[model samples]
Target: MQRAISIDQKKIDRYGKINGDNDIIHYDDAYAKERGFRGTLLHGPHMSGFAAEMGARKYGAEWLYRGRLHTKWVGPVCPGDVFDVRIDEDGVLTASVDEQVVLVGSATLR
Candidate 1:
């Protein structure tokens, strides 16, 4: 039931590097193109954070205590790609980017 969250480049870079992902495809446009990507891609965890952020905003900070999340990055999440985060009554959360379902999972709110 939460609105979508749009992550910026700085967040992706900082978080991606923190997670030990130094793939140029994630932070270097030229290198990413060499690897066939239009630009740096968003790390998978970034999407996770986006999902969590949406959950907190919609259901409050207490909603994630006993929650669960499951998602698959079907494709690389490029910079500037805004995603929509949705939560259903059953506790399922879905993150969609450009019509593609990037993150899908469930969590329990304590």
Candidate 2:
């Protein structure tokens, strides 16, 4: 399966609030730019959630009850970026933007 995941400032801020990731780099543009990022970045775990979603879509409750996910973040996701989220038939999950791979991993169920 394949889908596009769009991230925005509102979602980023909300995730930060819920997950207690109050890092200024994820919320403040100037702070992030000072750190050499294009804009306020997204929480890594929040981006990883797209993989969990793919697992759930494929494995149903088993994905939740007995799923294992391992990810490597190769790029950053910022507001207004659109990610290509997909689960290959091999069960590998990947998230990409503009030909740049942001995440790569696999979701498995027991």
Candidate 3:
């Protein structure tokens, strides 16, 4: 299965509020630039959640109860970046942004 996920400032802010992650880099573009990032960066956990969602969408309820997801953040996801989440027939999962891999992992329903 495959899906497209767009990262935006409103989503980031909401996630931050829910997760109590008030880091300036994830919210302030100027601050993130000063810190050497392209713009407001997405939190790692948020990306992890997207991976899990992809799994659940493909595998249904079993994924929710028995899913195992492993993800490595290889690069940053800035606001407005559209990421592609894809799962191969072998259940290998990958998430990419701008044609570049930003997250690599596997998702399986055990």
- Give all candidates' CA lDDT scores: 0.73, 0.88, 0.88
TM-score of model 1 relative to the true fold? 0.76
For model 2, the superposed segments whose C-alpha errors exceed 4 Å read none
**What is the alpha-carbon RMSD of candidate 2 to the true structure?**
1.1
lDDT of 1 by residue, 51-95 (tens): 776566656767557555665566666777777778777767787
Query: What shift in Å separates residue 28 of candidate 3 from its native position after superposition?
Result: 1.2
RMSD of each predicted structure: 2.4, 1.1, 1.1
lDDT of 3 by residue, 37-110 (tens): 88998899998888888888888889878989999989899998997888887678888898889889988877
For residue 40, give model 1's deviation from the true position in Å. 0.8
TM-score per candidate, chains pooled: 0.76, 0.94, 0.93
TM-score of 3: 0.93
Candidate 2 C-alpha lDDT tens digits along 1-110: 98897889999999988999898899899989888888999899987888889988988888868988888888988999997889987789999988999999998876
Judged by whole-model lDDT over C-alpha atoms, candidate 3 comes out at 0.88
lDDT of 1: 0.73
- Tell me the lDDT of model 1 at 21: 88
